[model samples]
Target: MRGIYVFSDLSLHERLQKALAELNLQQPTEVQQQAIPKALDGRDLLISAETGSGKTAAYLLPSLHRFLATDAPKSGTRGLVLLPTRELARQVFKQFKQLSAFTHLQAGLITGGDDFKYQRSIFRKNPELIIATPGRMLEHIKRNSCDLSDLEVLVLDEADRMLDLGFAEDVLAIAENCRAERQTLLLSATLKTKGLMQVVDRVLRDPEELILSGARDQHGNICQQIVLADDRTHKERLLYRLLEKEQYNKVIVFTNTKAQAERLGGAIRYRRHRAGVLQGDMTQDERNKVMDWMRRGNINILVATDVAARGLDISGVDLVINFDMARSGDEHVHRVGRTGRAGESGLAVSLISASEWNLMASIERYLRLQFERRVVPGLEGKYKGPAKLKSSGKAAGIGKRTKGRGDKRRGESEAGAKKPKQRLRDQKSIGKRRKPSGNKPAGDQAGSGALGDGLAPFTKRR
Candidate 1:
């Protein structure tokens, strides 16, 4: 078959090409164009590509081709894909199954929150491709239920997220169990973190470095906007209004907390929209069902926490509403990335309050672009924040502290000034007590107080 693109030439296996065609993938993505050929050449790869950039397939197709080309026994795992979350592992496994459809290569998923014995049963099948989370995979390794002795390729999908989730030790442990000569492919949304670099140094050898532009730049197709909300209630109203007014094929509302995700999902469902909740608190089976509902259009809206929705590939998500501003700029990027996938245009609206304005500004600075400020006509918020920003365009009230020496000295003087008034009141009380009463003499009073104390001592002893 002729190549679809200049880069997707004879380097890829014919079966892989047929699978790509069946998936309607006519051309290689930028990351795939750059990384796949080198990966096929048996080079250790460190790829940094934005979400929804076909990074999964970039690594998967090459690994599948290598497995199909080799005569090595499929008795032990040969290709290992380690992700940070169970959802990501399952999604990658699904992708692997799709790409390997024309070949006999088997892929198995092992993650926590699932039956270990059932996974071990899958392991007995001698799958060549293994998709798993670091923690669960490490458990299997320690239990002697899974073996990586014959592992040829180790793919760390979302290495940065794994490190964020504190899976560094687990990932390194799994890598240690794999053969030293294994080809390590590390893929991340960003590779600037020290932890990811350390993993790269430990696993990859003279790796081919491919760093694509960040998600913010790549997601220009997403129309970003900011809605000013006075408070949580106002944000909720704005969210409901947006959902009611705007037309979207499918929408994802992102919240910072699982509680908030559940609340918002419930609220949306109560409003008569088919909405589903995806958060860390949900069981693996429940999460899978929610994802299935979202994918199959049973639910038109999905409210999800950041960690739960990371690396999820749901297509045709037309709009993303950040119900709560993301904790960081990177998080904001990933939250919005759930939409505008695969060259489709999408919309992202972040509901920002007075407290979240600074966060929104930081994300704007990180992305090097300003979000268009929007308002609901009748439902305009009272907290519009600073009328004018600093020269850097960040929110004006932030990064300014009132803890200088002058303020400290002022506070000290105020506290010190109050002491004199207290001392004066004490002096007045002493003077009043010293003033002689009509019925008693000063010496008599002292003698009487002393006598009363002596009597009290005797009474207490009794």
Candidate 2:
């Protein structure tokens, strides 16, 4: 019933209502229903929702609502949103502009890889809301180009991701600099991350916890499948085949390394398809060009690293191919979630090599789901599913333990394998001690090169 709630029926001001009308945002998502009312109540909130769950609107609507209020003259930026990546920061800034389309309020973008002088000018303009990444925002804070003393509301988007990028201290320090009376909203897709809760405890003040969707439930509609491959060439063939065969308006292929993304980009381009590569090493201008191409449908395929996986909300990404599957289940969820978004059907396919089969199983176990085994007609790989499975249903890794290590270890452990190592010379009996030839007196043996301790006589090494 809550999912059926519409945006116009909610308490949003007419300005926002009109903007929502233009954005075609009529029905409130599950997250929006639960988060907006609490956010409007000026309550600090801790939310755990999937990516592309309308969580951005949930918080942005409330923050915009605050800006639309006619209560007090704005002192500084009344609202601040901190994200992990520049792309996500830009995405949120775009949405902020779209949502405030009907209002006179302004939102500024503060991120790295842009002209610092221009950002300082943006600070001088004193936008009502500032969307920034922690590092560059901290830089502005250090320069006094940015101030949060009069901040009214603060939102930390993808908080866990910020922590993962080693920004724990930076985020904490930024939160510390915000106005003490600010309403803080901390949102993260994966809540079980190590330092995420610590951040929640430190930043949010008695926040109401909002868990709208579990990680397992996030990608339920997306069809997940695994294609077995032998090696890199095999994978490339399979990928090229999929690109030709799969019917998709747009597709993103995720790889673990920038090098792989580059390689795949070239490979796809050679197949006569327009492809773009998005990674961390590229200049922001290059990245912007790629994303612009992506948005304009100039590029049908985009190869990217995990940098794009976290908080990006790209539309028409009907298919996701794991050229390289993610290292963790949380990351897999984010990758797959890029598709099948906003109640649209999508597909995610991962190419499993001999090396990646075990990782695939681990992710399956972690997510508590199974992947459909798919074989391409001419490009099927040698690496099918594993021959053995653990009692927990994960593929048994071909580890030392599985390779007769258990029995060998049992034999060794029974034979006192834990004992300290002994050199062969020390282990062998060279002869009896002979008591240092005490038959000869000590004084007589001293000149004979016997040890002063009288344990053994020195012999020349052959």
Candidate 3:
């Protein structure tokens, strides 16, 4: 009976069943059916599933069952769910509280953009569930507040996004404080990186792995399109033209940086469109208010960065506009995945400039779907010259501007981009040495005849 997944045969408490029925949840989703059983059985899990695949319920249902099934004599904090952004933490907290409305369970969200005093008071209640972001949670930990030793389940929702936001170290630090035998569940939209794999290895013990395919590449209901923009100005014009089509309602416009997000939001607002900016630099209160406005339909357009936009479960968003090319192909997927949520029909439009051509190609290749590339009626021109792609992780040929160390002003340094190598005591103690070069090594002629590796040459290794 252990580790077996059977939603049909599974029994839930009458109260929970009633709550589910009230919410119109008649049947378990494919992911829920498969994941809930193992989670309920107190097994660590690593799930690579798609966005909007009902992952929240998959983990929440089992967590609820565990809470209600076991006695909670003292609930200082029974479950800890770490998400990458404040929006996701709020969303998860809301969902869990919704399901636990008729039960004795209590849940709290610990995130930035809120009052710490209020959060402390909420945490003092010893909630059955605590949903948080790693950065804010770590702050709480450092203050000698919020005990996690009593945590029974530790869920890292959107695990890949957490790493992208540079929360890996904070996540590990917090996780180390949690009980060693606790049921740890890692849920991600994708997990191909070695860092993510290493995290899974460290956190999960004999985990039951589940890879729900098909959800990754095919969001059947969403129609994706790529539009060609001659330049930044042309892209803006095309965006305005698209918004003029009344059919596109509740649209979200994504940008790669905070400055662009603010500018776009300002332009839209100036045009009498209900628009707002959502970025990490905004205070928690400001971000919350903006999200509330969007949810309340007071704002028609949300211009945001990846940090602000990811993990948002806002309903009725019918259009997603990528103003700038996404840095990674996976990020492209996450951006489009926002609109086509909860089984809704949606449209995703990408504006690709000549420089972003390579990024566009990579996205198409990843999805295995070639979009029809077309230009707006008024905007048509050939690229004047080949624009050098930036040398960062961003694919070359996506833009004409290359931001390199050479581009920096006289006083500025490229320190932020250059990460120092992390030294590990164990690896050093192992005394492993890289094989020395037998000779002067292969020349450019022997390789590809031109600095030959496909990737840009890095600074010479010390």
After superposition, the stretches of candidate 2 with alpha carbons farther than 4 Å from their true spots are: 1-3, 395-462
User: In candidate 1, residue 23 scores what lDDT?
Assistant: 86
CA lDDT, every model vs. true structure: 0.85, 0.88, 0.81
Query: In candidate 2, where is summed lDDT lowest over 10 consecutive residues?
Result: 434-443
RMSD from true fold, candidate 2: 9.6
> Which wins on lDDT, candidate 2 or candidate 3?
2
Clashing pairs in 1: none
TM, every model? 0.86, 0.85, 0.79
The digit string of per-residue lDDT tens for model 3 on 1-462 reads 124443445576666777887888876767787888788788999998878888998898888888888887775688999999888888898898778878998888888877899989887888888889898899998887788888899999999889987888999999998878689999988877448988888888889988885334647788888787779998898889888863866998999999999999999988899999998799878988999999999997999998855678888889999999888778888888888786788988888887787777766777777766656666565653234434332344443666674567433544455555787864566666898555544564367434435555655768
Deviation in Å, model 1, residue 127 alpha carbon: 0.8
Error of 1 at 186 (Å): 0.7
lDDT of 3: 0.81
Evaluate model 3: give its TM-score: 0.79
Return the top candidate by lDDT: 2
- Where in model 1 is the C-alpha error above 4 Å? 1-8, 397-462
The per-residue C-alpha lDDT of model 1 at residue 269 equals 91
